[model samples]
Target chain A: MREKTTEPLVRIRGVHKSFGSLEVLKGIDLDVDQGEVCVLLGRSGSGKSTLLRCINHLEGLNDGEIHVGGERIGYERRRDHLLPMTSRQAARQRQNIGMVFQRFNLFAHRTVLENVMEAPIYVAKRPRKEVKREALELLERVGLADKPAAYPAMLSGGQQQRVAIARALAMHPALMLFDEPTSALDPELVGEVLTVIQDLARSGMTMIVVTHEISFAREVADTAVFMDGGLVVEKGPPSEILSDPSDPRTRTFLSRVLKETA
Target chain B: MASATADPIGESSLPIRKRPKLVQWALIAVLGLVVAAGAFSVVNNENFGWPIVFEYFTSPRILSGLVRTLHLTALSMAIGIVLGVILALMHMSRNRFVQSIAWAYIWFFRGTPVFVQLLFWGSISALYPKLILGLPFGGPAWLEMSANDLITPYIAAVLGLGLNEAAYMAEIVRAGIKSVDRGQSEAATALGMPDGLTTRRVVLPQAMRVIIPPTGNQLIGMLKTSSLVAVLAYPELLYSAQLIYAVNYQTIPLLITASLWYLLITSVLSVGQYYLERHFGRSEARSSLEAR
Candidate 1:
């Protein structure tokens, strides 16, 4: 039986992040349940990507707490005071969370198979034989089994992104964050990458994706969030958020995007 | 007009070829004549003592000195590369103190001439007569030795060339590390690899594409710069050649012999550099090709 817990897998309370004088994320609060796919829709500079980065502690928060898997991200409570965690501690926390980038960011020096196998063999300290077997399986699942020996530069943008997804899955992360996985892909190539992600969602993996794909979000996300100016303007099922947004800003942004896509 | 143009195009289509350049051939002919004249003047001049050059070119003493030059180049380059990598990392460190220390080292070493550094290393005993190994600020000493005994001529040469080369190498390595995309390391960090592992697995390999060409230049530069140690009477290639000319009074010939050897070594090193560039350039080739 699935364990029923009152606490969600990811919790964010009043998270704020800034770069110098410019505040990107201002007083954001959200939660994601286990095995749920949360799609964040936002225009550029709306803090969607920053919010995703904060979940994995890739960006430290200015003022707030993010708890992933019940542990405070980038901080520890010591004697009723929150203290910043050391790099080692932060790294350990990140091990349970996998992240994919907009650009493929596959290691140029490594072959596709080696890229998938690297973190498990080095960071997680898994046996090479076992990691290799799982890496090939992940590649096959992503429809890239034949291209394992090829370097990332030799692959299409779509293929490289698929390999990147496989690489993240090899870590067996409890949660995955995708920062515009198909944003950099050609329009024709975007579907293949989205299909791979859809398969992952169906497999009951917890994921938080920052993307502009309204149709994909409608089909895939359990919860759809519309964000603007560093705040969530509306949150509901994808059907409601995409079809009839309560907020005027959400309506305008969706229409703009849909018109462009159309 | 269409029919007229199409008929000629469909026919043989006039095979294209480069224009024959009467001017270029005349220029080449003149330049070749001038070069031949210069060569004939040099070969025919008795003052050059060409016979003496051929005789000492394979002399045992000069050959041994060549070997020593090779040894010094290999040893100094190894030291420069290892220390350079460390200093580059320290230069890029987050700690203010560590970063400034690396900055100071690169500044001091690069600001002054390497020749002065070599001279100082040669007469190091004059500055510090006794070497002490102990705790800082006048603590108990564990070992002691004479600086003269410790700093041999060979050690001095290695220190002079390697330490100076390291400062330049540090800058080159820093530029190389910076050339890699920020996303590369970010991806590694997101995968939970520590800073050091990310640098090793992701950053450095990509950095090598930018690092190798300049490093090969440094290696070739070091090979020639090592001849500077001959001023200390260390019996390197130039010094040994000077010793032979001093006895026979065939100065010009012996200088020519040494120049020939230097040219040969540099040529070989250039070829090696070409192959190394090709090796690290593998991944870049596809992207560049696609771009074209």
Candidate 2:
């Protein structure tokens, strides 16, 4: 059952996104309460990742609105018009939203510690001493305390993704967005990254994860959302949705993915 | 041949292979002969006047001219690189009028030959004999000065060389910026970094890897191109050589001295360029993969 009470932390109301003439998201409406781990699942090119990007303003909305932490995202409603914020103003809103990319987009030139400490020190304008202490603590939490000084290029793909997670957490954002975080990792390496994410979920960190790792989704996701063709086909608790999905498209996708792994 | 003969040490049943590198030996022998013949011709030719080249290479006139040449190159390159960076940013501006203005400046400077441009600058007084520091056309003048007094050969050379080099450097800088991946800028922006900070800290530092080598080449080219100012009679290295050879009728030796100096400076620049490339490219600190 979907939890729809007590002020949803993320509320998407009739959000529509299109690129040129092609509609990527058509009226996506959903809600996640505080501390809810919502796993977005779908086949390739089904607009799951696009929806996640829209939440962060990496993609613009064609119509409707999204609210995160009770504030309008990407656009400001002034006198019945959805006026877009300036790039600088839009960046300020992203400070509350941490995004982990599929490729782990860690700054290749900076050491692991610097990568985590960058946004906190430079963007947030925090004092270096306090930020350094917390950043080191984050690295230790991510099991990379020894690699604080190692550059991104020196670490494995899994380790880099872990550092990216640490970097995002250093901001202490209210909500985190994971765009197929482990999809780019090697099969064996994916476990390491997924383990760290599971720990985050257990600690009640609010997250919207877009992933194809069905088992990980089942284990950690409080709610499972299956989207297809720019719309959410079905959404329910992971236990109910994974075993007995009502939508035909969702069933077909799950069967194919599960068969591949088996 | 070495790989073909090599086999696993424990697998003793493999055949002992034999290979001869006759083709490589023959090529090396021919290359050695060509080197010997070329060196013999250059050393034996008395028209080169090796003794005269050695004697005047360090002459006070030549040395002063070399100093002037280096000074002109440094000033012109600094002006070019600074203006070039600004023009590149302007070219990438979202405003069409700004982009067009930058484009027009590049077109005008690059369309004309540097030699012709230097000549034009040298003869600027003929076009406008008097320059007035004033308001718009026909307005009251704040100050008036004769163009010939203001635009000496030295000033003309600096303007000509610096302005012309700026056009090429602008294109080089733009290309370097374009070479960076779009994801880099997106990540920086998503991290809430302001545009100016992102460009300076993230974009430019990464773009430096691409920008440095071509910029080094331009520096060396500017050192050689400073010679074009000779037509303005500015007394740079080539002009000084011409002045020396004109009086003594020793054109070839003096020219050789100038060429050798240019080569030596360029060699030093290449070494510095190599180190800069290594510093940026090999920045990743080594930490071996840890045990699981």
Candidate 3:
């Protein structure tokens, strides 16, 4: 085993993102250690999703640095300055980081197995036989082995999200980000997706999840972070933050969410 | 309640009737007679030259000309589709210079009449007598040829038709690319595919569902527009007919023969376009059927 170190798997320093005049993330800092499951809890428009996007460099940072596995996300670090990497270089950097969106953005034109196998075969240049076999295994893991031939439009929202997760897993990413994975699913379908994610958490994958599921967060997260209006309101163990929160904002937010779910 | 058992729920299901339209039937009858009368008069008229049209319809000269027209259409459309895709990408590009260049190209080509463009290409030697194969701005020429020799009728026709078609095709292609959801490209980007490969493998395939129908229309339109090449005295289908009629003085018959061939090809192409649209729409078709 590699020696445990103080260095985190994902490190963000004073990250700020904005769309024109409206700032989404304002000078945020955080760290996710290796093999940790960190769940971001917040209402809509609270910068949790934007922070996750910045980690994978899906959204560029206006000011700050995000490093995953000791490498900067979308920029090269020169002496005393940071220069943006070329798109090709930035794409290569994204290979190690997997992301699942709220809408479950599976390639609608691709079959389930093809979606899982796409990045491996096309981007990584893996042989078809090898990728296909592994892709089948991934489908089996997601409990979708029987529907490899099905297009995404034929699948339920929960099934599509699972396939999306498998698609991201095909790259064997070092870190995974889930942005409201079950938020779009039907109420009855949410459990299946949460179960899949809980299994992933148990398997020691380094994941940062943004979700409104308080019970799931308390069950799976090593660190539960409450964010509000582009800033982290409170950060601590799930037990402390979920049941007996310190911050008044966190208390208010949690109460509203729990009442809605209840 | 007791009588309902025999009738099985409410008055024999109301007979499932459609209202009769007396005016529609009367209009159809009148239109049919007019069409038949017109057809009979044309068939009876000796000057119409029906037999002459049939004789030259498959004549070797006319057949070869028909082949040339097909070749020109296919080649020009090939150029148009390829260059159209490139220009569409450039027009959508974030770079101001590249985007404006594409805009300028589309504006110039679409602004001018294609007939004038063809004529310009036909006498391009008047504009530039000698053509040089080298760099711009007084650079040394590696090879030189007369413009008349370099720009043959076929080449000129292809260039004129293809370049102009590309301008329209570019707009069609742009609309297609825009129709795709933004999330599709973002998902591809998240999977680590570069923008170019993502476009080819992801965006363009989805865009084809929107791009195919108008492209088919353009193809059919090109079949007829190719007749304009006759102005250059190039012997495509129409010009070939013109050649025969000029000798035999069978103007109407030869022209009729050429029209028949154009109609035939365009009809076939329209059917083909239907099948291509269905092929691209497979997934959506299946899903809609499932929904129904």
Candidate 4:
């Protein structure tokens, strides 16, 4: 695989997030270069999903910084303090960060086409004619070209997730986040959605996918990150982290995951 | 699981169809008895005054009053539902100040009786007889109207009904809003939509599935509540019936006439509301496949 850029596409430095008094992310740090796929692997309550959400700015940081494509997300550094940005400013940062959810939260009331084009036309202020043309092409890319007029409830879970991916891609984000994107799918439906993500990965789309599918992670991830107890236990190339690990917790967790699936 | 369920032999050889239910037969007998009793009473009773009911069914004065009742119900509910939607949004505001303001308004309007509200609006002149339309005190007045002129019987009834109706409808709308999944908003945020556009384009439309049924109930309730305006001397169907019975001393028959008209109007509204509910639920419902 060709490494596209030397500069990091995403940088997390000492990022800490807490819900009320319970700390979820404890002084986490990681980085991803341009056009790299980082798969986050962790047991439940290991802060993998929380860290992913922090990158998306759905959860605010209690400390530290997150930067995507060299720009801080959700907060601005003023002298010595990191101040939370306004909602509008925070939303502007999301334009370059796409997210696919575990349950495929497509807008139920809108047609597949409307769901794809809404953010581009309304938020980006793109011309309607152009957005529609690109949105149709995006739906075509996701293999949903024939069902643009269909509602989300009418589509199967895998199809809905693909439309969600197309919706995020319409903005042409710099980085994409996946929060266990296929965890809620039927076993049969999981493969199609993973295939789409794999395709995106090979084509050099920078993404951070939090998932339990170790095989998919091994197949697509340039880097495998294992997190436990609100900390990154180990992160390295897929070959080292997925098969052999230095940390005791990482080995136990990976073995248990692999055994459960087997 | 599928392989275990497959037919290894003649699985259909001993098919047993559904048997008839005793409950169905009992229900039909009870309903037939009730209908027969009702018919016998209607035919035999003289005080019901069936002849008088038919005589006045299409009478000009009563018909006009019926028209007026329909008009009031339509206009008041139209304004009420619109105000209700705004209040619902305000109630959901993140700003505590705006949310409290919406809460106080809803509490004030819904806490009181609608009849009392109509009476209060009817006699508003006793409190603020003159309303000057200009800047604060001592500023030059641009226009001034006595409260009596503004608070006509019709306007008072509308104000009373619509304002009070708005409070109840606001609750219904809020319940609908709450029923929608939180993930919808989170997903919209993930797509880079600002809060306002996210709510307007995504949340509220999905909330419609929950909001529509209760809102239709509120519409029908508004129609019935419009009768309270009769106490304010408005010439609605009930008031007109009261006026006719006062001279003829046939209060029962007159009220029966008004009741029938209310029924007719509400039945029509029910049909329309049914279609409206179907339209809202259509997005998630498989209408064509379900029908089959």
Candidate 5:
């Protein structure tokens, strides 16, 4: 096992989350260094996705702290009292972080270019001309320059997910979170979206992805965290975790994934 | 061709069994007979004179009244649509006070007869003789206008008709808005847009697909309902016909003239509605095809 480092870009400590008494994440603690691609491998409902959501404050945490780029998210210290920040304040913090949803929640009313430009113009308050220029550049980066004027409903599932990534990247976020970006796509369409993400990973973007595509995880991620039952069951380098998992649950999950892939 | 003929019958191969030819022919014949009966009665009736009908329809008073009816319908529809959108947004607002106020507005207007509301508005002087505009505290000088002086019959009719129709329009707008998926709002929020801007730019455009058909229906309904304002002697189409009949005792002829104009306008509106629906539908169809 590699020695755990003290300096990390994202630090989650003793974080707990519950949705109306149904606890989804229980006491999760993990760290990802700067520019590291960490793939969270888990079955459905294993809290891997919820943990990624917590870092951006997309999902509220019941207890503990999350820090992204060394700034605390969803929490405030007021005269020795720790308070959960209001939703608007948390949203401002979320600006430094960007998320792509499992369902590729693109704004259906907007064209591909406008979808990428919306956050920069509305949230970041960038000038319209600059935002449009940057948005087109991001679209070209995702190999979707031809779809600039296409509404989401006019794009394939894979194309829409790629546009979603461009939309997130347009903000120039410090960390990008992807929650099963290809899970909702057709099997044939999955590779196109994964290739876009793989390209992003190769370009040294800090990413935390909750994904089921084990081969992509193994090939692209620097570290892999295996989660089960709302807890991080094991954490190590991708070769160690995917090839030689220590925990029985991790081994069983790998066996199932391998069998399905084969 | 041999294989196609030998294939077992599927859902579409039930012999295209339509109504028997005799039955269809009978239906058309019955419809024609009904129309002919109507025409014969009109032609034979003592009050139904073609020359009198033409004269009454071309009369200056009746023509002016027809113009007034059309003008009122257009003005009321415009005001109703604007008010309806605002009311819809207020009804959907998260603030409890605004929602309740909107609810009360729709409730009162929809529950009461529009005629009663018009009468009440026309006689607003009986309740509040003056219209005062000022803040609760002493912020500015009060601007007072007397109800009797300012509340003209035409203004009362417009207010009554527009406000009453707005209640129905609000429901249509709410339904249109609700038809959009909840995720659209979440996606807009994720993009960090404020709620109002999200609604204006993202939500309302999509909601228009659901809103426009029902609004077109409401406009047609309002065209017919505007005739009720004649009870206040606003000199609308129906009242103009009544005034002519009261003088010349040609009741049926004048009513036929008014009916002809109303039918023409409503038919035009119906055709407009059909084309608008088709336009929206075609775009939606194209988008779904692209999605697939």
Candidate 6:
């Protein structure tokens, strides 16, 4: 792993997202340093996933701004007015940010190799041969080299999620986002996906993960953020936040999580 | 588990309840009765001679009419499929203007009776006596065709049937497109594939699973619907049979002849539809198994 850098790779400020008067994210402010793994921990409907989606502009934010690698996402300045970027521009910006959905939203029609190679050829405009080579390497790295020709439907849930991670990585994104990647998997399958993610973290890939896997968070994440009722209650080093949290909400959450695992 | 033990010889395990053999026998008996009734009518009727039935089918006039019937069916289906695909694409477009235009086309065609459309087109000569083929404003005429000369009854019938079918096909296509998950589009976007390539490569191929079955139904419907063209005196099989029966006064036999041929063609088409549906079903089944 590379040495930690002082400059942050992503900065989110005053981010508020609402869907029809129901505010899901309220005035969020966070900074993630380059090559750092940040775990966003929250209960269901606590806005952890919503915050990750906002970073990619999958769900538009009503009030606030997101910056990736120092560039503001979603909005562009035109004639002194800041307007949301067109759908195409927003999609282009999303190319720099890779996302692995909770449900393993792999392209069902494509084989694993095709899924990994698709974005590089079409989105990044890389040569087909080059993309194929890189995609094969990624498939090998994810321990799925033998399943390149298999469709997502043929793989187990954990395998499908790994393919999804490889597909996201094939784009060479500067930052990766995982929105509860293992939540949809079978209990036994969750560990396989977590292992792949943990490997990525060890390799120094910058990642923001929203997960209920406290053990994985405590082990792999550098910073742990505890969110409750659409707001961050506590955030600090994993050892401190997971064991010595000052906020009562954080303490309650950790106790509940520990009890369930036990 | 206790309930299963209480009823050790469950209803499913009983020999008498094993299979619905009685229901199967009843269906067979019903089918036999219908076939027997049809056979009896043909055999007992004085005018219904098998020789005459064969003779009429092999007659030159009837054979020519058969050829014409086939021509009309082929032509209409060809035109219908091409126009139908276009309308389907239009209906699925995201642009408001394009979508509205498609909606208007579907509403207008589907709202009107096909019979009326046929008659209107057949009599379009009364309104536009001359067909102009030049620029709207002031360009010289490249060619000119009189409506009466160019707009034959057959041409009018084909146009009416093809255009009307396009509207229905558009709805079928829209349903097919909607069946695909929204994530498919997002995945394509994430890959940086342009909209058109994404539609052609990713979306449309998956949508075909939903599209092909309905399109098969429409093809069968078009085969029967072609009978409507007879009202315009296009000399297709039904109209030709009507002409023969009116003179010979053997209505039942002639009608039986025409129906037999229709059944034969539709049966062939049904087989084709079955095979196509099976082919697409296999791929869908494979994909679903993978998803599991």
Worst 10 residues of 3 chain A by lDDT: A1-10
lDDT by residue for model 5 (B1-292), tens: 5685686656475556766699889999999999999999978887677778888877899889989998999898888888888999999987899999999999999999999999999999999897778875655647989998888889999999989988888888889889888767666666656677678877888888888898888888888899998888899999999998999888888888888888889999999999988775654776877767
Q: What is the TM-score of chain B alone in each candidate?
A: 0.94, 0.89, 0.94, 0.89, 0.87, 0.84
Q: Please state the error at residue A63 of candidate 2 in Å.
A: 1.5
Rank the models by DockQ, top first. Answer: 3, 1, 4, 5, 2, 6
Who is ahead in DockQ, 3 or 4? 3
Runs in model 5 lying further than 4 Å from the true structure = A1-7, A74-77, A80-92, A121-129, B1-26, B44-46, B135-141, B288-292
Query: For this target, which candidate reaches the highest lDDT against the unseen true structure?
Result: 3
Q: Which parts of model 4 have CA positions greater than 4 angstroms off?
A: A1-6, A77-80, B1-34, B134-142, B287-292
Provide the TM-score of chain A alone for each candidate, in the order shown: 0.97, 0.98, 0.97, 0.97, 0.96, 0.96
**Interface RMSD computed for candidate 6 is what?**
2.7
Clashes of each: 0, 0, 0, 0, 0, 4
Tens-digit lDDT string for candidate 1 (A141-187): 99999998888888899999999999999999999999999999999
Which candidate should be chosen as best, given DockQ against the real structure?
Answer: 3
> Per-residue CA lDDT of candidate 3, range B1-292, in tens?
5664565666455767788998999999999999999999999999989999999999999999999999999999999999999999999998999999999999999999999999999999999999999989999999999999999998999999999999999999999999999888899999899989899998999999999999999999998999999998899999999999899899999999999999999999989999999899998987786677
Docking outcome class, model 2: acceptable
What are the per-residue Cα lDDT tens digits for candidate 5 across A50-124? 898788776777988888888888889899778888667876877778789888878776778888988898888
iRMSD computed for candidate 1: 1.5
Model 4 residue pairs with clashes:
none
Q: Please report, as a residue range, the 10-residue window in candidate 2 chain A with the lowest summed lDDT.
A: A1-10
What would the per-residue lDDT of candidate 3 be over residues A1-262, giving only the tens digit for each residue? 3456769999999999999999998888998999999999988999999999899888888998998999989998889998888889989988899999999988878899999999999999999999999999999998999999998888889999999999999999999999999999999999999999999999999999999999999999999999999998899889999999999999999999999999
Task: TM-score each candidate.
Answer: 0.96, 0.90, 0.96, 0.91, 0.86, 0.85
Question: A1-262 in candidate 2: lDDT tens per residue?
Answer: 5546679899998988899999989899999889999999999888999999999898889998889999999888889688998888889998888889999888777789988988998899999999999999999988999999888877889999999999889888899999999988989899989999999999989999999999999999999999999999999998989999988999999999999888
TM-score (C-alpha) between model 2 and the true structure = 0.90
